[model samples]
Target: MSGPGDVLDLIRERRAFTRGDVLEITGMSRMTVATRIDALLEAGLIIESGTEKVAAGRPSRRLEFNTGHAFVIAANVDTTHTTVALTDLAGRVAAEERIEVAVADGPDVTLNAIADRAKHLLADGRIGREDVAAIALSIPGPVDPDTDRPSQPPIMPGWDAYPIPDHLKAALDVPVLVSNDADAAALGEQRVAHPGSRALCFIKVSSGIGTGIVLGGKAYRGTDGGAGDIGHVKIAGHGDLLCQCGARGCLAAAASGRAVARALVDLGKPTASASDVGVYLADGDPDAARLTQAAGRVIGEVVATMVSLLNPSEVVLGGVLASPPLLAGVRETLYPRSLPRATRHLSISQSTLGEKATAVGLAAMVVEREYSASAVNAALARS
Candidate 1:
């Protein structure tokens, strides 16, 4: 019975393994291993794959976790849009949709819209409501990691201490988990792109500026889940500038994607949201590219300090400003401003996974939460 968790862990960690391998790794008798495998099979957590030929005796059946056993509902909400997706237990997205909505419209309106989109995505993926294991969400503000609720979010009006899990749970009828957008983005990048990195940092330059840190393959969310809120750090030169957090000369007020968009609009170009800046840059708009790079320079000034403090091996520039201009601006400042020893081996680049990063991270987190040792034990008891 105790071998179930061990067997599952081995299979998940190694991708595929045989019954004999699990027995050997767990040091459990053959009968106990067989019984544990049966229990996992009954719970639909794992499946037996084709047999592997041993060097000597009978062929052993290889076991792997059933990724399609259940579905996870994930949502990545930003200031101007929301992405909803249905993913398998392995964080593979089946179907996804992006809804144009505003985060400033209050959580009730935005969360309800997201719930409707999620239900439709589930149907599109051909997964039933009862098949949902959990729901996960990431927003463009600080979140209390312990409680999965918003925490005094400066830009998100009427969202402080909102019961995000309760609202989504009422609509979706499953456990809901929430985190800050930057944290989820970093975790996704770490899991998929740089799995072996010891220290990684993701700077999210969306409607605002924030950072997410991953140390040793885990998110380093500090006490009260406010570890990476770097947007409010004041800059010396921009004394008269006011930030959305009611602070003067804040980094976000000077260098965020939103700031760039506002600047473009003031320059007689039509720009609505931070995502619009990305669209314009992608279209090779010279003005957009130039201003975006300038903003990146301002952002890089702050990131250089972070590089000195953290000495992360990789720094991923993500969200709407993940472009050549941003990357170049960051490199321009980070290399010259940071300590030579700290940045000798540092690599900085744009986000590869794009908008799907948060959705995938949410699915991976929900799967991990649902299948931990204690959760597995409780599930077996219920079975």
Candidate 2:
């Protein structure tokens, strides 16, 4: 690891630290630590916040990271809406706005809208466009992380094999990272709500249902990037309803927000979209609650398998329809179906971060990518 990068990491983890603390923890020579500190300060990546009071001798100055040294753009795209935000290096959102655009509009139209909105948000924040260190995007589909491209996304048509990173990089003139929304939500929820969680699963039930897995504080996207894609899991008896993936009896077709909306329409409630269903739920519509509860039970059938397979410590329910019925349905089915050993310590609950989970997750991923030891070293050396 680069000395300056390690020093910066220590400061970030500890929030504030003295040169002596860095030297001791890093086991670096005094001269090495001093040189690293000087390099970081010269690069404007850190600030001398204040001195720590000492009982004896002279007080030592504590170093703190300069979170505003650069900014990152984070975008969270779902089936019916997109959110773009400007965040500091520490992933704290400085400005954010939501755009009501349908993902069915295709990648060209949607990604362009996101890029344009990000520019406007940066303008509103009065941050120079050139100061953007990176951009992170969270989409409602499985992403091939190796290539940062959507891969056979059932809900997101015209996005398959789309070079999202290259497209966004062309528009924003910075490197871009892309991930599935469920994966992003998992990371965001785990970091904020369950920081101590070693095995966590975030379930998103919107136009589609997906799961994000995290273990040991890091994402566990299986090889080829389709690990937690529980949406396509087939149900034994429900072969009547067709899924967006061109398959029958898929969990999404039976249990997603769209599924319940379709159910509501069957009962003459006639919701055009999941967002409309959310409105019905907000207004305490009993039919919506009942269908949602049934949807949850269907999803719970799939989640039971996941709990047994991964034995996650936490199962977070999120998305537009993460309401009472869904939460209750998941808990009701998950508790009884899952093995006793797996359910012993598992905590299933609705997401506390709600709609902001994707944005928070995207920002965190960007920060981690931009502030890795090698990335920091490379950045300072170029500077």
Candidate 3:
């Protein structure tokens, strides 16, 4: 055990523990445990919550991770809007807001709006800016792992290689972490909804399609941060279709929300974006349902390959068009095409968190990054 950081992790893992329990589990000297525990208490990372009776003479004071020690700013940026939330260290939302800032408006306008809204939320909640540990952002595109910036996003024009973290950090004056929206949503779902699922996949079918994979309770970003760009996966018999990435026969071109909306528009339903498609689906529009179902089947064809490869415990469909018809279509094609072994333990479902999934995931990312053992240790040393 290094010190308070490890102790904090132990307290957080157990929810409530005593100094004697830490000493017993770590096998550290009584004096050393006292020193570490005192340091954490001083830093406000851990707090005493009443006492627990022991077999011996005296009772032991119970300690727990102090969720109020700091807050996290979680922002999920999509094509049409951004959802900003202030979350506790425990990934619980304390306050949230929605802003109408389109990604197509470019980063400057959108990021500034997000920062302004976040500040408003903090003020409304009576939380100081200094109390914020970090900010986590989820964008509707792939983020470069090395630079922490958007990397050649197709629908997100003018965002390629943009210094997203740097821009947000400058505005917020705190550490900023950027991730793909799908990846964030996957992490959020796994942590909140499917806590037992060690391996899971989240497929986001919006204006574009993306996949987020969680293995061993962590988001699996690929070598270049393009692990789940399934929207661009080439589907047979769609060669005539073109994607926003200037590619032909891409899955998104044929079956994404944009594709469905386009088909709906051709049929004279007057839909333009994924949100519109979602409204129609909710209203039980037959044309919209039919198109969404067909799109789901096409997406399922691609997911079948993923199921075979990853053998995930759960596959969640998220994003704007995640509905009953879509889920049904996916089940129709995915199970029939996937191997029996893969399908035996697989459970496919719609997103439980709905629009809040990305924000929850971003909060998880913030907590994991800001409160990791090393980060906590560094803060303690500095203090």
Top candidate, metric TM-score = 3
Task: Assess each prediction's global lDDT (C-alpha) against the native.
Answer: 0.85, 0.85, 0.89
lDDT of 3 by residue, 1-383 (tens): 99689888888766438998998899999999999999999999889989899888689999988888988888889888888888887668878888999999999988999889877877765777789988888888998888889888878878999888888888878888999999999998998899888799999999899999999888998988998889998999999998888989999999999999999999988997988999999999999999999999999999999999999999999988999999999999999999999989999999989867776777777777788878899989998
Candidate 3 lDDT at 23 equals: 82
Greater-lDDT candidate between 1 and 3: 3
Q: Which ten residues in a row have the lowest lDDT in candidate 1?
A: 1-10
Give per-residue CA lDDT, model 1, range 227-292, as digits (tens). Answer: 878899899898788898888999999998888999999999999888899899999999989988
Clash count list over all predictions: 0, 0, 0
Q: Show where candidate 3 strays beyond 4 Å.
A: 13-21, 48-63, 123-125
Clashing pairs in 2: none
Model 1 misplaced stretches (Cα beyond 4 Å): 1-3, 50-62, 122-126
